[model samples]
Target chain A: MLDTLDLKLLEEVADLHGLPQGAYNIRKNGQAADRKTTANIDIITKKDKPGIDIVVKPGTKEESVHIPVILSQSIGDLVYNTFEIGAYADVLIVAGCGIHNPSSEKAQHDGIHEFFVRKGARMKYIEKHYGEGEGTGQRILNPKTIIEVEEDGIVEIEMIQIKGVDHTVRDTEVRLQKNARLIVSERLLTNLEQTAISNITVELLGDESTAQIISRSVAQDNSHQDFHLNMYGYSKCRGHIQCDSIIMDQAHVTSSPMISALNTDAQLIHEAAIGKIASEQLIKLMSMGLTEDEAEAAILKGFLK
Target chain B: MLDTLDLKLLEEVADLHGLPQGAYNIRKNGQAADRKTTANIDIITKKDKPGIDIVVKPGTKEESVHIPVILSQSIGDLVYNTFEIGAYADVLIVAGCGIHNPSSEKAQHDGIHEFFVRKGARMKYIEKHYGEGEGTGQRILNPKTIIEVEEDGIVEIEMIQIKGVDHTVRDTEVRLQKNARLIVSERLLTNLEQTAISNITVELLGDESTAQIISRSVAQDNSHQDFHLNMYGYSKCRGHIQCDSIIMDQAHVTSSPMISALNTDAQLIHEAAIGKIASEQLIKLMSMGLTEDEAEAAILKGFLK
Candidate 1:
């Protein structure tokens, strides 16, 4: 039972525009609905399988496919989903998970997604996790994402979590083949006693492979955040990791980025900074007639953006 | 007796071009020589005084004075020095300590310098510490610098230690008053089995005060380095701390920068980065017919410069 607010929240987090009348859509971990024949995408369900699979065939002319799995305010069971993207398919996938727990008897969701990118294929994946509830129940989400990029394949991922989750543990692991490339950009904001931990590991196994990982986070009001990224270079490759965070009001943040190389030609680097808001930034903004609180809010918005 | 090599090393560190015939000069922990009337600087030595004092009177017109205290190959004692700059004085002091130990016994130099800058004065100080020896004797240097910037005063300090020291611990502390400004730039390079630790603290006690601290370091082979900087803001002030390091071949480096504020208008920020050389940089240099080692050396030179 989904209402207009539920749909709007799902659309905001999952990039859903209109109703699922033409393209393929899945609702509440259910079967595919309103499937299009000429869309080059197929959704199938096993007779006794617990999760559904959406496959994008090779050489698909479609630019992207949007599939959002949402949970409503009622207490419900956890959902599991998987995606299989074919080789040589140049497309984008807009996928995310949104939970609205107003009645709140402790709602939870655990999504495990694995991606396979074939040779010479390029994929852009964007995922945003969000939660909202007025009830006293806890909202928890634990996500595990595994990605593999074949030779000459390129994959770019952007993950964002702005608010509302009480606790989350995100784990991502990636492997790159010869000449493959991977880029991951993550942005998170935790406020009011929330907790977030991210563990990411990348391995450059192929010659001339490259990887870049960037994380930006903000913690306020007794929140806690920990981020760890490790990159291993086995062959002649390049890698760079950057972590930036802002801590305010008894909040605690820790960032540890490590780079290890077994090859002589491997080049790797990492940069991390954790501090409070700069006074000059606030002064410059407040000089334009805004209050101190307004200035801080504006700076935080710009930093997250 | 100072030979050609000794003179060259002193000149390299203190920028001494010619003998001081009119200005004060000190060598080997000795008293000031070549005292002149045109210079308003006085060197005072008292009985049982552990360190010598050089006082610069007000309205001193001399642009710069070079004072280098050298230590030969013998197992010697410590050297201490102090500086007192009067009000309304605008001058530069280029001072350094170089130890050439070619013996079997351990050699060390502990130089402690304190500076008192009166109100409305401007001073620029540059200091370099270096050591070289072929024997198994340890070459160690521990230098402590204390500075005070009065109201409307400005002080800029640059410290450099490139090579040859087996171990070093550099400690610096500064206090700034109303409208006062202080800037400190430190560059260090540790190779082989050497180690270095730098601890710096600054307190902004007056409104409109500012301070900036920057550190650049490189560690290679089995060397280790640690840097810590803390800034406390008691009024409306601005401060920034930056640390950049390059680690290679079993070298370990750690950087911690903390900023605390007691007032509402204090703004502070810090940034730190540690990593090895980038592959693209090496590739770009090698494409121009340079070898890997040559590219790395060039990059290191440019970074240190």
Candidate 2:
């Protein structure tokens, strides 16, 4: 029972053209709009809390879950979701949130997600934050993610925030065990008077564990952005952190990538860069019969691609 | 006249196979070993210092000068050199230093270079630093460069320090006027127990002034490095600063790139990144019939290229 606006928001945030095939949950305007569960996956709503717990069977394969949220009215919604992947199982989780407020009241959403991957398990998580409306109301979204990987487990997370959110602060923390691996990539953009702050921390605490964090962002007009990342190696592990940004017009960007190695065999490194578009690149594009503005737009599109 | 070792040192540092044409001066073992000059360029010994002053006439073109320093013995040497480029002229300047210490005594050299580019003039400066020898003594080099560009002037500088310097520090400063441009590119590598520190600063104080600073460095084994760069835009100007570093083994690297904009129309950005070699890149190279060590070497070479 979703209208055209709800369908469009789902497509924009989670790449959902219609109702998902596998287990899924859809919440709109602070209430559950649709839900479905499969035999291998169970999405049980918490009796004591305002959220759901997803449990996947052992050795489950080719199974996925979609927990997408949308808002068409101004409201304050806060939810907590937990995920547990069984041993040797592999799964995909798509949890995206979008807000379309057309009222004068402010619209805000806070989602806190916690995940646990069992021994030898693997998971791919994708979460997107988006906002759109022509109202005077302010759209705000705050997302928190915590993950723990057991021995020989692997986890990959992709977090993206493209446009329209007035304010956001993304917080993430991860811990890896023996022979575990973790990779997190975040891409974001901020324009107008919007501001975004991201804090990510990862710890490799077991032998041969590895983690990598990569972030790319752009700030345009009068926007502002800050990225703070930290990686710690406490055993015979390896870790790397990288952050890059582009600043345009009167925008401002600040990046800090910190690494600490406590063990003798631990190897860690970090790098960050923030600058505007290269003039030579713009000129090269303009030479191909494109206007200055068009060339600039094309370059920015490519940079964020 | 110079000996075989002196010629080899020249070739290693300044790319001079023999006596350089046009204008040139060679210093070896704390004394002048060769000298030459052309009609438009004059190399005159300083009366108050142990150095030389190079002067280029107005509208001069296709003219170049070489001032290469070589130290084959363990000795302490210090020199100060200055250059004056006339208005509407364009020229190239090569100043490189190499030290080969084979004695038990420590070898050190400190060079301070100052340049004044007149109105409408342009200059290209190339400098390379290198050290070698199987000696118990340490090799140390400290170079300082200060430049001031007048209206419509341009200055380009390339500084390189490859290997074998046990300890070194480089310092550079620049100031640009209206329509003036300054570009500085630096490349360095440190290994073993060696340590290197670099400090570079630039100020854009006029309308339409521009400055760009690019740095690439690699630290291997137990080596350490520190790179500090600063750029300030005081008027309606543009400036950019970028630093990239690769860390290997038990080595450590720290980079700080800071920028400040004081005017409403001023635009400035700074970026710094530090990391190890990508495993995928190494695997790709190894698939082409290369060993792991060879692939690592090839990647490092390409990175610094």
Candidate 3:
């Protein structure tokens, strides 16, 4: 029982082009719908748990799944989703959340997502959050993500929130075991007095574990943002963090990156930069018959990409 | 008459390998000494001024001068020096100050230097400051530099302070005329609870003026450093500021760069990064049979250079 707006939002956030025949998919709006089960994946919910459990069978071939949550108005309860991958499985998950509030009341979504990757499993997860409305309603989101990687497991996550949301606070935590790897990329843009804060923590708990975190953000027209990335290295591990931001029109941004090592063999490094667009970049684009504003927008798009 | 210590200090600061017979030179301890005059240069002291006046004749060929100051012990008076360059002149000035105190008392040096560059003139100025002693005495330096560049003028300044300074506060200001350009490069190293603060301001007052400021610093063993660079663009000008710092062993560093454009055609940008030495650099160096400490020191030296 989906409407036109729901279909459009699902397409926007989750890239749901057509109905699936064999692949697993989950559509949730306060309750689950169109839940599928296949030979390689099993999606089930328990009576005592609040969210569903996804089990990818061991030694499964490369596969994909989509889970999109949408809300067209204010909701009364929170949303919780969990995913568990088995050993030697290779899978990709495309998931996101979108809220549309076209009224005078405030609408919010607090999403909690947890993922567990077993030995030698590899996973790629992408999530995008957005809001759009012309009314005076406030669209807000507070998302918390927890990830655990077993021995020799690999996980890569990409999160993007580009426009329309009034406020957001994203919290992410990840732990890596022996020979495990984690990579996270975040892109955000805030304008018109909107605010955002991102707190990310990564722990390299075993030998030869590696992690990298990269963030790109833009603050325009009195918007504000703060980013904190903390990485801890226990054994002979490696970690790196990087933050880049562009500030315009009295907007403010602060980035603090901290790396602490408990052993001499651990190597960690970080770098941060905050400034406006470079003149040479703009001039080079304008030389190709683009206006200044168009050149700036193109450069921003490339940067986020 | 100059003593042996004075001669050694001059050699260390100004690189005075041999005495020049015709070049203009001004050596000051508490007062000016070894003042010389040439055909294209005249050194004169004014009655109402606390410093000397250096006049370079217009359309002169390339020339070189050395103005080095030394303070072997504590001094109660402030040192002031000024230079005035005529139109279409080209010159290079090597200037520095050194303080040596081997007692329990604190030693201080406050030097003020001003330069007036005429239209179409070009200049390259280099200054090196240092302090050395074995006692519990503190070495403090407060230096102020002011520069005015006329139309089509060019000025480049390089300042270095490597070691042995306990405390220092450096202030520099510059004003640029039409089509003028200014460039400044600073290198510093602090260790063992030392502290340093650098404040710089640049004003582009005419059309097509350009400026660049770059600073590289190192803090080790509980040292502290702060850098502030402010650039104001009032016309169709361009400016960029960059700061990079390395911190180790509980040291702290902060960098703040501000660019204010008052015109539509003006473009400005800034970047700052603070962190420890990169592991790749250290590993690359150590792979060449160097020790870890040696590799770190070599990296620091290369960064300062």
Q: DockQ of each model against the real complex?
A: 0.08, 0.08, 0.05
Candidates ranked by TM-score, best first? 3, 1, 2
Q: Which regions of candidate 2 are displaced past 4 Å? A: A1-57, A61-84, A96-116, A132-156, A169-187, A197-220, A225-305, B1-57, B60-84, B99-119, B132-137, B142-154, B169-187, B197-221, B224-305
Error of 3 at A140 (Å): 5.1
TM-score of chain B of 2: 0.98
Deviating ranges (above 4 Å) for candidate 1: A1-9, A17-123, A136-153, A165-178, A188-207, A212-305, B1-9, B16-95, B103-121, B137-151, B166-178, B189-207, B211-305
lDDT of 3 by residue, B132-246 (tens): 8776888887889999999999999998888888899999999999999999999989999899998899998999999998988888887878777778777778787777777
**DockQ of candidate 1 relative to the true structure:** 0.08
lDDT tens per residue, model 2, A117-163: 99999999999989999998999999999999999999999999999
Per-model lDDT:
0.77, 0.87, 0.80
The fnat of each candidate, in order, is 0.07, 0.07, 0.00
Tens digits of lDDT, candidate 2, B1-305: 67788788899999989989889988888898888999999889999989999999989998999999999999999999999999988999999999988987889989999999999999999999989887888999999999999999999999999998989999999999999999999999999999999989888888999999889888898898878787766677888777777778887776655565545456766656566777899999999999999999999898887
Per-residue alpha-carbon lDDT of candidate 1 for residues A83-106, written as tens digits (9 for 90 to 100): 666778887777676777777487
TM-score for chain B of each model, two decimals:
0.94, 0.98, 0.95
Task: Residues B71-132, candidate 1: write the lDDT tens digits.
Answer: 66655556566787888888788778777887888777777888998888889999898887
Residue A198 lDDT in model 2? Answer: 92
Provide the lowest-lDDT 10-residue window in model 1 chain B: B29-38
What TM-score would candidate 3 get against the native? Answer: 0.63
Per-candidate interface C-alpha RMSD? Answer: 5.8, 5.0, 6.9
> Which candidate ranks first by TM-score, i.e. highest?
3
lDDT at B6, model 1: 67
